[model samples]
Target: MIFIIDSLNLREHEPLVKDMFRLRKRVFADRLGWDVRVSQGMERDRFDDLDPAHVISVDDEGRVVGCMRLLQTTGPHMLSDVFGAILDGEPPLRSATCWEATRFCVDTEVLTGGRASNSISYVTSEVMIGAFEFAMSAGVTDAVAVIDPVMDRVLKRSGNAPHGYLGTPKPMGKVTALAALMDCSEERVARIRAFSGIDHDVMQPHRVTA
Candidate 1:
């Protein structure tokens, strides 16, 4: 399927953003029992209001399948401001061009399976490309994602391998992040597209007889 990347400002995206948050609460707070503070039936935080944050994701027939949050570095991200305590009380971020990518999640029920499923797991391609486009247009050069180890594998395969950025994986205790910078190479961009296609090809089976 041809997945389009839609980036909307809060005023323009209130509805979709609302849906995204509801899905987040359903998955992160309600389903996974994360102790996220609730407000107006949506989970929110202080950082949510700051940094002219950008929301990028795949719109699958009006449902948000994959999503990621990008916070431009006007102020310190969790890595610089919050994660330090766990990472020896020191910030790992090294560039003002960095934008933090967070809340990267895929709707599990709609996710593909085995090889076919693995194919579409690259859904983040469009989202990342969209985010990267936004950054490049805004004259940005660096990016970061604070993520879990498993999720880190996805980033690594996508060519965002994080070895020369700022730090290495550590015993983060409760701390977590994909935590890597953006690499704007033609090959990297191509990989993002290739994988996104593998992840989001429109063709699907015509029947389900179960």
Candidate 2:
């Protein structure tokens, strides 16, 4: 199952949020070797305090298996505040309808031996669907993601490729990162669901306010 959580209400979902942060620490800080802040084995930053909406995937045991963060572009986001170098001299994007999707990761440790561990598994697509649905619910029309080439290719191979790109690809820590823009629409959501064989609604009743 998936849950959409508002940062303000994160304490209400403590266990899920803790698992998500630990998963991020593994993916970003330990595995990916990004220069991010970590405390008590959890990776987090200032944006987290800004109350970005989070879309999370949980297993039958109620543990976080995958997660993604969404921040309104009009406010302070990674692309604008931290990863300006990825923009390659282009001005930062700030718009009410465009939100930034960051901290996207999955629990690779647990998904190493199943169909869910594949390149385009239900876990990945389900979170993508959840992100789009959550954004649309909040009146966002587009999403920009700062991703490495691996994730970029994953998006393309899964048939959810970005509709536009914002910056040139450049080295960021251990990986080369770029900014890609994807539309927040039902069409994209349908494509992801069809590819992942997920026929039911992935969105939970919980939602975040912008």
Candidate 3:
């Protein structure tokens, strides 16, 4: 299931958030060598301090398998503050209707399937679905993601190709970073669901407290 956790409820789901950070450390810093900050086995940065909404995918056993971070573009974001070079001198897209999606990663050691149940492909698609759905529900019309070439190909293969791109690709760390613009539309969500064979709603109900 997918869980949307933000600053308001981050303390309520500490374990899941911790696991998500550790998974990011393994993927971005340890494995991909993305020049990210890693300390005490957790990869984090200043953006995390801004309380961006984290879309997390948990398996049946309650393990955080996949995750992504979403932040409003009208404020501080990676593409605008950190990866402005990708904009090629063009001002970073800043709008209330648009959001920036970043820090996407999955646990490869745990999810080893191809496209089968609980596989990497399945989890990736699930995370994407959750992100887009959540953004669309929040009155967002578009989502800009700072993704690498591999992730770009994955997005295309998973039926979530970007509608357009801003500027040109630039080498970043061990991969080339590209700014991909995707619409948060029902059609795009449906295409992903069809490609991943997921028909039911992916959002998990938020816990209600007295």
Q: What TM-scores do the predictions have?
A: 0.73, 0.93, 0.95
lDDT by residue (tens digit), candidate 2, 1-210: 778888567779988888889999999998788899999989989999898888899876777889999888888889887889888777799999999999887777776533452322668888898888878877889999988888888788777999988879888678888889999999999888776778887766554534
Whichever of 1 and 3 has more TM-score, that candidate is 3
Ranking, TM-score, top scorer first: 3, 2, 1
Tens digit of per-residue lDDT, candidate 1, span 1-210: 212223333564567677676666665566555446677777666666664454435444677666666665557566666545435555565566666776666666666743343333555555566555556555666677766666667767765565444455554434343356665444565677675554332322221111
lDDT of each: 0.56, 0.83, 0.88
Ranked candidates (lDDT, high to low)? 3, 2, 1
Stretches off by above 4 angstroms in model 3 are 207-210
lDDT for each residue of candidate 3 in 40-63, tens digit (9 for 90 to 100) = 999999999998999999999999
Which candidate ranks first by lDDT, i.e. highest?
A: 3
Candidate number that wins on TM-score, 2 or 3? 3
Which ranges in model 1 have alpha carbons more than 4 Å from their true place?
Answer: 1-8, 30-35, 92-94, 114-120, 163-178, 198-210
Pairing residues by index, what is the TM-score of model 3? Answer: 0.95
